[model samples]
Target chain A: MSTAPATTREILIATIADLLDGVRTVAVGASSPIPAAGAMLLRARNEQRGRERVRVIVLGSREHNFFTNGSFELFDATAQGRVDAFFLGGGQIDGQANINLVGTGDYPTSTVRWPGSFGSAYMYYLIPLVILFREEHSPRVLVDKVDFVSAPGSSEGIHRTGGPHALLTSLALFDFDKEKKRFRLRSVHRGHTAEDVRAATGFDYDAPANVPSTPEPDAETMALLRGRVTGELSECYPQFVETLVADRAA
Target chain B: MGEIVSIEALAAQIKDGMTVALGADNSGPAMAATAVLLAQRPKNLHIVCVPISGIQADMLIGAGCVGTLETSAVTLGEAGGAPRFADGIRSGAFKMMDATCPAVLAGLVAGQKGVPFMPIRGVIGSDVLKMRPDWKVIDNPFAPDDPIVVVPAIRPDVALFHAREADRFGNVRIGRQAELAAMAYAAKTTLVTVERIVETSLLADERSAAGVLPALYVGAIAEAKQGAWPIGLAGEYTTDTAEVARYAKMARSADGFAAYIKGFAQRFEAVA
Candidate 1:
C-alpha cells in the first residue's frame, strides 16, 4: 500500500467493519451502500485472518444473497437470532435513539414524508446488535426529539433481544447508553471536534473532556477496504463504487 | 371450474371498493391484472402489499384506481421513490395503513387459516402500536402475565399476482415465492397471470410438484406472457430499471403520470 490519503468515507466504513468483530452475520438493508461496503470489508478481513466463515447478506446482490423470500427471510432469520448485526437510518433521530423514518410534521400526514418504516420496527427488536448509520450529521437529522418514532431505542413492553448499539455520523460516533437512555460521545472524527458536534446536533449528550479523534483506517485495513471490499461491493452498488473507487483513482 | 381465461376477464371480477392483496417483491405484481384495473379505473379500491411494492402501486394511485393502500413501504427501487404515491398521500388522495413486513405476513397467515387473529412478538412499544388501534396486546393464555401483540387477520376479497408458470388444471408453480401461496390462500378468490400453460400432469410430476399451488386455491388463471413486464417475474427477467425510472419521474404530476401510464396500459391490451 502506498502513502495515499484515507477518505473520511473509508475511515467510517473501516470503523463499522471493526465493530463487526464478533458478529457472525451482518445484514445490510436495501438502501444502505456504505454499510454494505463496511460489511464486505469485515468479511474480507475475516478471510485474511483465516477466521471462521462470516455471512454478509447485502440485499439485491445475487452472489451475496441467497434468500428466496427477500426481506421476509431477513425478518425470520433476525427473529430466530441468526443475524447478529443490522443497519438502520432515519430522516430524524433523537437523543434516545428514536428513529423517524416517517417524516417531519406528524403521523399519517407528515409535511415531508419519508418512506414508511418497512421492517425497522420488527428488526430493531430481534437483531442483537444494530449500528445506526447516517452520513448527514446536522440538527435537522439528529434532533432533540424525533417527530415520529419509527423505532424506539429503548423499550419496556416489547421483548427486544437487541437495540441501537451506537450511532455513527460524519463528525463523530456516540455509544447508546441503554441504562441512561442517552448517547455518550465515544469519539469525534479526525477533522472535527466535540464542539463542532455540539453545534450541529439538536440533542444533548455526555462528552468526555479532551475527546479522542477517531482513528483513521490503518495501512492494511485501508488496503482491504480499497482493494477487495470495493470489488465485492460493485455487484450491488455500482454507482457508489464508480464514484468512490474509480473517481478517486482518476 | 374454469382453469384458464383471458387476463381481462379475470381482472373484471375485482369490483369497485373491493380490497385486493398483491404479491410480494420476488413474486412480482400481476401486471396483466394491474393493466386492466388501470383501464377499468374502478373507484375506492384498496390494495394491500406484503412489504415493499414496486411501481405497480404508483401506477394504480396515478390512474386513480386505488382509494387506500396498506403496506410496509412503496418505492420504485433503483428507479426511485414512487412519485405518484408520494404526491397522492400528501394531498390526502387516499388512506394509508402502514405496517411492518412480518405483521402483514402474519395477518395474511391468520386470514388463510380463517382465524380471528395471530399473536406476534414485536410492535408492543413502537409507533406502529399506537397508529394501529385494531392490533391488540393481550396476556398470553398459555403463559399468563406475559404480553403478546396479536394482529388481525387480513382476508382480502381477491388476491392478484403473477407467477412463472401454471398447469392447464389451474395449479400454479410459484417456486421459491412461498408468500404468494399465503396471499392466494388468504383471499376469497385467487386471480393469477402466468407466462405459460403446461400440461395438467406437469404439476403432479415429482420435479415440479413441490412448487405447485393446488387447483382448489386458484379460482382463475390466464396465460399472459411477460405479464410482469417493467417490474419482473422471479427467476425470469430483471426489472426494466430505465422504464421504472421514467415512471418515477413522470408520476410526480397528474399529466405526466397520465401520459406515462397510457402507453403501459395500452401495451397490455395488444398482447392480451
Candidate 2:
C-alpha cells in the first residue's frame, strides 16, 4: 500500500492474515512468531471495525493465552470444536499435504531428526482450518513423499472434521483440495513466479494458466502490523520483532 | 506427609532405569535436581517429558544419563533446535519414543484415572500412530465404521519438577500449570524442588489453594532458591536466551557437549 515494498516476512504475515479471514478463535503453538503476528493483525483489525473480536491464543504466553489448565485445556477445547483455526509446519511436506515433523529416513532411527511432532496430529484433524506454514520452499523441505508422516493430510474413512486448508511458503500459496488430496497453486508472492515455486518444490501441484501474484497488505493493514501488532508480538517474540525493526531500518 | 529432603537425597531416590516424568518447559522443571541427577550419572533412565521439554532433557541425554526419552518434542525455543537431542537421535544414544503432545498428556491422564487406555481422536493415519505399536486402533463402540486410537496409560516411577513454593505441609503451589498435577497423580513418587518452603499453609488461602498440589501426592520436597535457573521460573526471572544460545552452539559435538557439561558442573560446584 505504501510506496515502500513489503519485506518477504511482511508479505507472509499479510498472506496469513488473509487466510485467517472469518476465523473466530485461532490458536498458535510454541515458537510461531509469524502466525501469531498474523492472528494479532486480524484481531486488531476486527476490533477497529467494531466487529466481534477474534480470540488469539498464543501458547506458552501468560498475556495472550486464556487457558489456565495448560495444554490439557487446549486439547480438550479443540476436541470439543472450540478452536476454529490453527497453524502447523513440517520438516518435510509432500504434494499430498502430508507433513513430516519427525526426522528423515526410517522410523525409530532417523538420519536427520527434527523436533518431535507437537499437537499437529490432533490439531490438524480437529481445527477446521489448519494452515501448513513452512517458510522454506526448497525440494528438501517440500518433498515428493515425506520420509515420515507426522500427520497425514487426509485419512481414509477417519473421523476428521478438519485438515489442511492451505500451504504457505516463502515462494507461493497453495490451497489443499481435500477431495482430491492434492495441493493447487493459489498465488505466488511478489518477486517470485510460478516457475520459481515449481523449481523449488519437490512434488507436483496444479497451477492455473495465469497464476496471480499474492495481494499485498493495504496501507491500513500495514500500519496496524507495524504499530500495534508488532508491539503486542514483542512480548512473546522479542527477537523476531527486532528483525522486523531491522527490516524497517533497511 | 512429605518430608523435606536435600536435592541429592531426591536424586538418590531416582534409581537407574526408572521411568521419570518431568514437567514441561513452562511447567516449572526441576533443573537443580536435574543437575544433581546429572552428577549422579544414573544409567538407563527412561525420561518421560510431559508433552515437551528443552535444555534440561537435552543435557541429561548429552550427559549419557538417559536410556530412553519419551517426548513430543525437545527444543530450546528461540535459541533453536536442541543439538544434543538431535545428536543422540542420530547416533542412537537412547531409544526415542516419538509422541504427539496430546498423546503424551492423554497417556498421563489415563494413568491418573487408573485406566488401561484412553481413546483420542486424530492420530489415525499419522506415522506417530504407526510407530507406537502399544497404541491400538479399534472401531468406535458408539458409532459403526468410525475408528479411534487408544493410548496406553504411562505411569512413571517418579515425577520430578520445580514449583514456586511449597508449604511446611508439602503442598506445592504450581499455579496455572495443572499438567504438573497430572504428573504427580500419575507417578508412583513425586519429588519437588521449590524456590522456598513457607511455614504457612499454601492451602490456607482460598486463591492459593486452587493451585496447590496436595501433600498426599508429594513424596519429598527440597528447597532450592532460584531452582529453575537459566531456563528461569515463570513470573520470577526471564530465560537467559544468551546462555541457552551458548548451550545450543556448544552442544553440537561430543567434545563441545562434554566441555559445556564440565563447565556447568564447575559452576554448580562453585555455587555449592
Docking class of 2: high
Model 1: how far is B231 from its true place, Å? 1.9
lDDT of model 1, residue A85 = 97
DockQ of 1: 0.59
**Quality of model 2 by C-alpha lDDT:** 0.90
DockQ per model, Cα: 0.59, 0.84
Candidate that scores best on TM-score: 2
Model 1 CA lDDT for position A32: 82
Tens digits of per-residue lDDT for model 1, A1-250: 4457777788789889987777889999886889999988988888898986789998767778877764468878888889999999898999999998777886677678777788887888878889999999999999999988888888885467889999999899999999999999999998898899999999999889888888888788888888888888887788788878754455
lDDT value, residue B177 of candidate 1: 75
lDDT of 2 by residue, A28-87 (tens): 998999999999999999898788779999987778998988669999999999999999
So what's the TM-score on candidate 1?
A: 0.93
Query: lDDT of all predictions, in order shown?
Result: 0.83, 0.90
Tell how far residue B127 is off in model 1, in angstroms.
1.7
Q: What is the interface RMSD of each candidate, in Å?
A: 1.8, 0.9
Per-residue lDDT tens digits for candidate 1, residues B158-266, read: 9888888888777888776778888888989899889888875555689768777888888899888878887766578877667677777888789998888788867
Question: Would you list the clashing residue pairs of candidate 2?
Answer: none
Q: Which 10-residue window in model 2 chain A sums to the lowest lDDT?
A: A1-10
- The predictions' CA RMSDs to the true structure, in order, are 2.3, 1.5
